[model samples]
Target: MLWWRQDDDERETDDEVEVRGRSVLVLISHYFPLLEVLDLSYPLHCYHGAVELSHLKKLRKVNFSGHSDINDKSLLHLFKSCKVLEEAIMLHCFDITFDGIAKALRERPTLRSLSFSKTNGPVKVRYESAYTTSHFISSLSLKCLASLDLLSSNISDELLSSIATERLPLTRLVLQYCIGIVQVLGICCNIRHLNLSKCSMVKLEMNFEVPKLEVLNLSYTNVDDEALYMISKSCCGLLKLSLENCNDFTKKGVNHVVENCTQLRKISLDGCHKVHANIVSSMVSSRPSLRQITAPPTRTGAFSARKVKYFLRQGCLVC
Candidate 1:
């Protein structure tokens, strides 16, 4: 009940297209100037020549993941061409070094989001300064960035701190499995959604606060009950909290969240074995604003799923 098409005419290059194992991207970019999204994350060698992609003025999103042949020069050139680009997803792109990123960020001030997962290639050092060296990363400033996602990368705390210091209007930040980003920069007060799942080495004090945070995801992190309590007290308007696999949460922490975070809508307690199931149930029952709680599908927990369903069906449910 399916079919295949290999011809260029048969391919749908109007909106978005997946080009793999080929070299026609050079010509395709010239044709699709109005394309809003492009996925070049295939295991292919594309754009062999120094093609000028400036023709794509309307491009908004681009994915260059898994393109092993693209060196830093090619990547930089591509990013420079797409000035209207908003989101860029680069995964497994081993050719992009730190200096290459610095160059792109300096040029594209309008970029809203940059997602780089497992893309830290050979360090093409531009200078011999240390990472902690002041102003080493100041040149790489994105003024309009609203979100940043770096998964499984070698992002340093200095790098994050520098970006936060830029006072970029960032609202959402996701750093899943990124090492060396232990201390969250405090100047990121405008952040609304933050996901730091699977970053195990991150330790925190009670000083960090995000006033505008609405959603938080810390699954599999090293944060304890004190961290959660601080966040609940600081981010009072938090709507969603994902504490899955947190090994330190107890009944007291859960009660604080229920009593203080009056706007919380969803909470995930999957694999938080330290937390009592009855406390979770009580929190849900007390917080009428809560919509859902994610737990293990097979865990024989004390919190009855049927009881939660009944509460949600009742008139006490809040949107």
Candidate 2:
């Protein structure tokens, strides 16, 4: 995979040739077969031209993350050229629409994985209505997809349902900030890492069987103590858990974790306010196999006269 960054110099170049004096035509004329992945990232809102990329018949994976200028029209152009393309990650490129994505995926049958996470931008006249709800729903056509990361991308319910019932070959899926994902009643059969942080739903309420999941991050979500209890009863293979900022969890949730998920190696509770320092200390010392634990800072209480004297004796040290 080769990662390319677009710059203003690329845009200022003469129309006769691209910035590098090499277009997709030149690439196709030379290195055609060995190319598997091509990434064009960074320098936001860049017009990285991909209209000539149609020549690479063997191109599979393409990443356009962090490119704000390349919108639905550019994506359509790229997809029209690369027929064999599989995975495409377009994080922060908010100029995509349902019609464009659906048309492209429908035309390209070999596409597998499609990710659009954290694709947000400032208010602009040209790219105002780029990311539509329909565009997310259009992502349901890829049946061969194995992984998807739509974290913080404002996904919809129709999209999640498509993944659950579309007979997908998905293995690794992330739906972070997909506020509509209330129940995995039908999904989560083969997911490996399922992250639903900052989602809208208060309760997890998963009824489907996902025996293969290894990592589950539900931090900043609406899951309460009862929901955590249910997850502790299920999801035996969960290795890493993030329950930070979940206001509903109390000591009950902590106790549930201690009893279940004996193989958990890492846990993050940075913003969980209900958890006390004593419980956190116990978990840190008791869990022999625990590798990492992230918690928020603590404040000291009113000091006694003896404590004040001790502080005076042990002055602060500077490096």
Each candidate structure's TM-score, on Cα atoms with residue i matched to residue i, is 0.81, 0.76
lDDT of 2 by residue, 184-223 (tens): 5346477777777767663556554456777888887767
Per-residue lDDT of model 1, residues 195-298, tens digit only: 88877567654375566889888888877768778877888889998888888767677778888899988888777877756554476568888877775323
TM-score of candidate 1 relative to the true fold? 0.81
Candidate 1, residue 44: the lDDT equals 26
CA lDDT of every candidate:
0.68, 0.64
RMSD, every candidate, angstroms: 5.9, 6.8
Q: Give lDDT for model 2.
A: 0.64
